[model samples]
Target: MSYNDRFIRACRGERTDRVPVWYMRQAGRYDPEYRKIKEKYSLLDICRNPELAAEVTMMPVRKLGVDAAILYSDIMNPVMSLGVKFDIVPNVGPVVEEPIRTKRDIERLRPIDVEGDLPHILETIRILDRELDVPLITFAGAPFTIASYLIEGRPSRRYLRTKSLMYGEPELWQLLMDKLGDMVVTYARAHVAAGGKAFQLFDSWVGALSPRDFERCVLPVIRRIFDELADLDIPKIYFPGVSSGELLPSLKGIKADVIGLDWRVPIREGRRRLGGGYAVQGNLDPAVLTGPMAVIEEQAADIIDQGLEQPGFVFNLGHGLFPEASLDKIAALTEFIHRYSARQLQNGAAAKEAERA
Candidate 1:
């Protein structure tokens, strides 16, 4: 069976027949089938079982006709391999058994040996590689985002404890980042070697810091992760979450292929802000999917128009899909993206041909 490469091509600043569309967290909650699976197993349980994980990962692709499939593993999966105990508690996020703070906690962290610690995840990627024609995107949390989880134990609105550590113990903060960064590099390599076509570094909470703080406290480690993995030759996407539009200038030096945008920034404006060299993904408001169908169609088309004004654009939501997002809406939007972009590309080619004739 043939698969799609439009998403991969777009990520590399290459032209394609149409924009590729896939949502973050596309495989979970919204789908009734996934909810049935959830009744049988917890989120981490799915991650631990390669077959189950692959099944969940492919659900959105088969059902929604998304152009790509992200590995159905949590960002905290690698952290657990590093010896941190945590649970994906219902109604809450990752709740670390003991938060990391001092030098001893950092020292206690072990280097991830992917084969030994995460064979299940690698096997899942291998399954996806054989089963998927579209790109199999594997991702891990960015150092700063994972660091927040490690320091705070759970999700927080302000990330107060994380910021305090950055301000109060700069050296210790570097130590933690170094460990997590190295782990991300190794984990990413493993995923690629196992046949992942792309990788996304999800710094979902990194926007919590000010520009100065992000540069000082966070940027270096992320830079290292991308640099170390550059030779892999896969598209590397940096998802810095909301407020990342403001942080783009600071991140210009990082070696990543695409900068994901949240809905707060217009895609065209984000393209200009990123200095025009890299491709971009997203900036759609996911909430719109819950409203009227006509409104969703209008907004999705507008995003596509803005995205195509430049080269290397991928159509996606600014963030992950919410639990309540309509599956029907997702399918309709995807079909529209493929059809509309193809028509646009075809018409452009015909016009150029007429000029030559």
Candidate 2:
């Protein structure tokens, strides 16, 4: 089967010819070709330009032969579309203006007009779906992550504003979450309608909340987004970052088809926690790609081995590619996983059969 078909099947908890591989932020700053494109267009420009976005999205697939292509965009795009002002600073990540402070601030936030600010994202998806050979996945910021930005106003080491609202003003926090949940569902559904085959909800800051806080304040909203997208037939991937291992079980009620594991959680442990039915993606440390090819191969091999224990698995780095990662090493890892992991699986299965005989 083709890589895209294999990936889609695996995400649905079905067997595939081999483990499918892709990367978070696969179409970003690592590739020289991507850099050349960026010189002519800014990060926001490329995301807003369909042709440029499509070109960037296809670069990794062409260079590394990845199984899927994520739409070239950021977590804050939807927030920007919702009338919040923001800018992306080089190395510094996103900076948001007017942090939500009161019930009045939450009430003032507008609904996203998917047709208005995000038309280019839809156009890019249409272009990729037509031209690219792999499955095109699009993403949105999960409610709490978006809320974190809206509350804290930027990337924060301590999510003080977010927790203050959650713990101190419980009713207002729930109200904000309720509103953002509705927006996430609408945004994800729009991508599916525009030809995106898969959707990922990036809960990048949800780890800041305790398991109790997450279950009380965040889990229901995440579940609602996934449940709303359940009818779309596209797999939904929920990726909660660092120290989020405990949050895995809370995902049980959410209707997501895939669970994305970060490097902090081992793939075997994540599989054990998430159980056998759902497809799992990632857990490889993205930093390993910066090391020697041998080390990269060793880490990739281990992740793939653990992934095979599950019914469906898609190989990936735990998070977005670092700007300085070696593209050649990434290519080598992809080819190695595509080639050797299947053989390893075959040899193991044959040994089991011999033992049974």
Number of the top-ranking candidate, with TM-score as the measure: 1
Q: List runs of model 1 lying over 4 Å from the truth.
A: 354-357
Top lDDT prediction, candidate number: 1
- What lDDT does the true structure give each of the candidates? 0.91, 0.85
Q: Give the per-residue lDDT of model 1 (tens digit) for 95-166.
A: 999999888999999999899988999999999999997899999999999999999999989998899989
In the range 159-210, model 2's lDDT, one tens digit per residue, is 9888989999999999999888888888888899989989999988788888
Off by over 4 Å in 2: 1-3, 352-357
Q: What TM-scores do the predictions have?
A: 0.98, 0.96
Clashing pairs in 2: none
